[model samples]
Target: MSSSWPYPRWIAHRGAGKFAPENTLAAFRLGAAHGYRMFECDAKLSADGVLFLMHDTTLERTTSGRGTGGDQPWHALSLLDAGSWHSRAYAGEPLASLGNLARYCLRNGYFLNIEIKPTPGLEAQTGTAVAHAAARLWEGAAVPPLLTSFQPEALEAAQAAQPQLPRGLLLDSLWKGWLETGLTLDCTALVCNHALWDSSSVLQAKSAGFRCLSYTVNDEWAVQRLLDLGTDGIITDRIDLFAPGS
Candidate 1:
């Protein structure tokens, strides 16, 4: 690890992803059981200004609830069954709040990569809300969670809200203006798609003082490629496949 870099090399996607119902407490516990020290999960706001976990704009995919998740308050969103959609064993699991996750991860010494997933037309609001909430929740901690987003406006809002917390710009492709956008946002790192990094691009980003990371890297070939490039971090859904600190 670099001197200024203070995060794990491997981060569990949405807290164990395919292994457990994602974004729930059960998923985080499962990730810990699988020996993951750092986890990546999505964070967005509900109608009532509460920070909660949910990846999609609608809840039908992960939770039993339907329609827009951000339209409902925490009181309604928390009671829904967020786990049963995956399996019967995790049937009654309820949605967890940002505070709940913070307490659990802090108590057990785990790191977090919080992806600010905003609802449509509310990107800036969601990013600022999540950042402020994370800053408050992680108060007095030695290190704060790394906030990331594909939306530059959101990341900019996060930077404005809490400059102390580190941020990363997520990119699915090497757009023409991506490097400038990340630098403009004052991000500490750039998280890109697995295939986005190569020998040349990795060197360029590193030389420019940007830590490069890859996401959704679940295969051996992808892992080897990233390892060869000396990428800073890897987020994967295959929690059981690649052991942390290996």
Candidate 2:
């Protein structure tokens, strides 16, 4: 049997391009409309312990709600207009919970890369909640979403809670013994910022039998370079730039 990971080359960032309300179902649908079959989203826990899609530490930037996201209850967070900040046309777009996103993706045969964006002190809680929720949401599906995080503690907690789900370690830059850190967390892949990858890094990850994926690549030349270097996948914000056949 082949032991390759199943993932699409083109993944929409935070759902669609940044042109839409990021992390909203609307953004995901927009990407899908543009022929994207895979998506990457940020997952975090609300004050009441609900796992939801969000990227920032606070709500001021992405939503009408105020204060830190970790300090607000789900009731308050859910009511905030998460879309209006992006554009007036997207006014009143609601926050999407992890459960909702999982259902949407699974039902549509879409692949997902769920990045665990836990609040500083709530790594364990966020990991546990996300894993458990994913386990429940994707029950009986053909393929489960890939869980990932930059936080080692969060990945550890997620592994302990749900070992069946695949996990990846996200890195902004490589540090001393980065391979050891990935091994410690039992990651199946290493998702890094685009500029950090080179032929040596790709070879090292391949030698370790781990998939290498790069994020936020939007240019044609960069994509071509990554492909030439044998990257397993490219996570891009320019969803319209490439498709299954293009």
Candidate 3:
């Protein structure tokens, strides 16, 4: 990392964390309302190659549709009630396309962290398309969305597609060769699982030239620990409990 991180210290996870339906425009709006200037969401490509916000490969958990979400074209995917599963308050909220999200963020001057959640074998394609779309969407802007993924191949493809956009390696574990992989991918940041970041791990990542970030950090103690370790960012689901910029 260049020690020149531009993102905020607090990021609202999946929009407003667990407060609203995750990865929806409604969630993002709620996140913004709670004073979050930066929001994180998942992005995947539909069958027709349209980029949209969705976290799972299958739609049963979060949307009204069944089977793989990527199996459907954008026209069909757009009609699903993505919010009904969450609660009646959010019933009938359509799945939001990346284009819709980009416009919303750009218009409001908010930052984004887009996790490229590709379907089972389309990692490279999704990464390439997302990078190209992000390049076009945030062109000439002061800051670009931080593209991140657990799949190194996807990040590599994204780098090959649009090297101008910053990339991060998401780690659920500090697996063997993790550091080398992040370096090879030209990552600007290393986003690790919350439980993995100790002082030693933070030092290791910082020494290798990468900003440290954690995900789904909710409790105040954990937040305090991360801050004490001097990490660059905290991705949290507690938008109500942990006010942004605090």
Top candidate when judged by lDDT against the true structure: 3
The alpha-carbon root-mean-square deviation between model 3 and the true structure, to one decimal in Å, is 0.9
Weakest lDDT window of 10 consecutive positions for candidate 1: 1-10
Question: Residue by residue across 1-246, what tens digits does model 3's lDDT show?
Answer: 466788888999999898888999999999999999999999999999999999999999999999999999999999999888889999999999999999999999999999999998999999999999999999999999999999998999999999979999999999999999999999999999989999899999999999999998999999999999989899999999988883
Clashing pairs in 1: none
Compute the lDDT for candidate 3.
0.94
Model 1: per-residue Cα lDDT over 177-202, one tens digit each: 88888778888899999899999889
lDDT of each: 0.91, 0.88, 0.94
TM-score, prediction 1: 0.98
Cα lDDT of model 2 by residue, 1-246, tens digit: 125677877788999978699999999999999888889999998878888888999888999987888888888888989999999999999999888888899888999999999988999988988888888888898888889999988999999999889899999999888888888778889999988889999989888878888988999999889999998878888877777432
In Å, residue 33's CA in model 3 sits off its true spot by 0.5
**Whose TM-score is higher: candidate 2's or candidate 3's?**
3
Runs off by more than 4 Å, candidate 3: none
- Cα RMSD, model 2: 1.6
- Candidate 1 vs candidate 3, TM-score winner: 3
Q: Model 2: which ten-residue window has the lowest total lDDT?
A: 1-10
RMSD of each candidate relative to the true structure: 1.4, 1.6, 0.9
Residue-pair clashes per prediction, in order, are 0, 0, 2
